[model samples]
Target: MSKPITKTNNWVLGLTGGIGCGKTAVSNMLEELDVTVVDADIIARQVVAPNSDGLNAIIEYFGQNILLPDGTLNRAELRSKIFTNNENKEWLNALLHPLIRLKILTDLNNATSAYVVLVAPLLFENNLDKYCNRTLLIDVPIATQIERTAKRDNTSIEQVKSIIAAQMPRNEKQQKADDILNNDRNLSLVHTELVVLHKNYLQYALQNTTNAP
Candidate 1:
């Protein structure tokens, strides 16, 4: 294991959950409260943009067939290739994880909010939680995850299940989390809970600032 990447002057709250578990909703609520959110998904796309080094390297290894007619990545084709082959998945992870992590760190460090939310689906899997002052998991039942993801993405249930299997298990994530927010209820209820969490995070951020030498 590597040491946690230290932030320059921000309190980071690592937020994650399995697909369709309302991680976005929670992040959005926090953002409405003026919290800075450093989203790994957005950074992932930025790192592999049309003319990026990440894209060029991917094309070099997987060939131009991995790209679309518009010179952007053919994500569906690449996803199919990686999902069926563990070696390809590992290779892709090796190439992209570091780049994503660096970009996430940069964004988090640059954020000017009282606290920052680092939102990554693979937060614990990639050891990103280690960078946080605390970790939060947006939890839901597996059935809910499969149903919601299938409906939202228009993907088959089996495909959603496969993606869920690839993630850290729900119980394992619960064990790792410093806080867990059950997202099985309505959005209004979730937001109500989040307001309290947001206040707690603000206080933690203040304490971190006060204690910094």
Candidate 2:
């Protein structure tokens, strides 16, 4: 693993939320504002890309059935297996978390942003908040989560509900947050909040660091 960003300088903001809470939308807005955003989901996929060490390790343990005909991960099949079985989930995490963490650290260390956002759906669950100077939670009602997720994923409401149930709950995440972005309404409303947040984060990062990340 690459060495962590120097301890004397801290500019990382860990951004997270439950399913369908619009974390991606917020991240996109931040990116458009020229803030660097390192998405863990993207890194997670990279670590397990075909022929990578992560993928080879996974196949060694879980068999070739997890791969699609094109030699890529059949994510839906793997998701069903892991979530249905606790041991499977634990095993997958054990193999992949270190790989993903190394990549994230390296990216953060190299980033030139005034501050960087480390976006992870499992930011809290995976204890990634430790890497951040602060945590930002995108908040929404459970009903909103279920409704939006069902629509976006083309899955049943029950399936969305089950996924939500498996993740850290909304209330718990909200309580742990250092900042919140309420995403209950339209994008314009969320964008308004984000404008304030972008300024706040920029100022906060400037206050915290002597120089850029």
Candidate 3:
């Protein structure tokens, strides 16, 4: 089990899964029920948006070739760079993780719903689950992941596999999760499961509120 780096008053439900594991679908259902979801992927992009401090720092490290003609981060180029070099990946993570974490925490703090859902693909890999009251893993088979991601992203199987390789494995995520939802079925079935989880989260939030000092 990972230890939390910071304690928060909000009842945070850490939601995660492997690439293409239907995390967005689950988070959307929760949103329909009025749950506030803080998405780390969005924050990750925001931190590196054009002209931002994060982008400036990245450019300082990687030079002009890291940007597109539009002056935006060349994500594919950066991905290829880091994928081939462990040291570069580590350096990049060291630079960006703190910025991303800070933004995630800020958004979570501002959320007004009964509970906040912190949706992060790298939740366990980055140890972000330590901030949650409980963690939920959306699990699907590796075949499903590759198929879904390649279809959705219009990417090659090898590219999808590489992305999966970069993520924490399904078994490892399962071992760390407080709850797991199998997402191999259709959206309707997945939503049904989520409804139950939503109710449980609401009840847990109420309990936490009642128990607060």
Clashes of each: 0, 0, 0
Worst 10 residues of 2 by lDDT: 2-11
lDDT of 3 by residue, 1-213 (tens): 965335667899999999989999899889999999999999999999999999999999999999999999999999998988999899999989888888888788888999999999989888898899999999999999999999999999999998899888788999999999999998899888889988898999999999999
- Alpha-carbon deviation at 95 in model 3, angstroms: 1.3
C-alpha root-mean-square deviation, each candidate: 3.0, 2.7, 3.7
Give the alpha-carbon lDDT of every model: 0.93, 0.89, 0.92
Q: What global local distance difference test value does model 1 have?
A: 0.93
The true-versus-predicted C-alpha distance at residue 200 of model 3, in Å, is 0.9
Q: Candidate 1, which segments miss by more than 4 Å at Cα? A: 1-8, 84-87
Global CA lDDT of candidate 2, please?
0.89
Off by over 4 Å in 2: 1-10, 80-88, 211-213
The lDDT ranking, best first, is 1, 3, 2
Q: What are the TM-scores, per candidate, against the unseen true structure?
A: 0.92, 0.88, 0.90
Report how far off residue 154 is in candidate 2 (Å): 1.1
Q: What C-alpha root-mean-square deviation, in Å, does candidate 2 show against the real structure? A: 2.7
TM-score preference between candidates 1 and 2, better one: 1
Q: Supply candidate 2's per-residue lDDT for 98.
A: 88
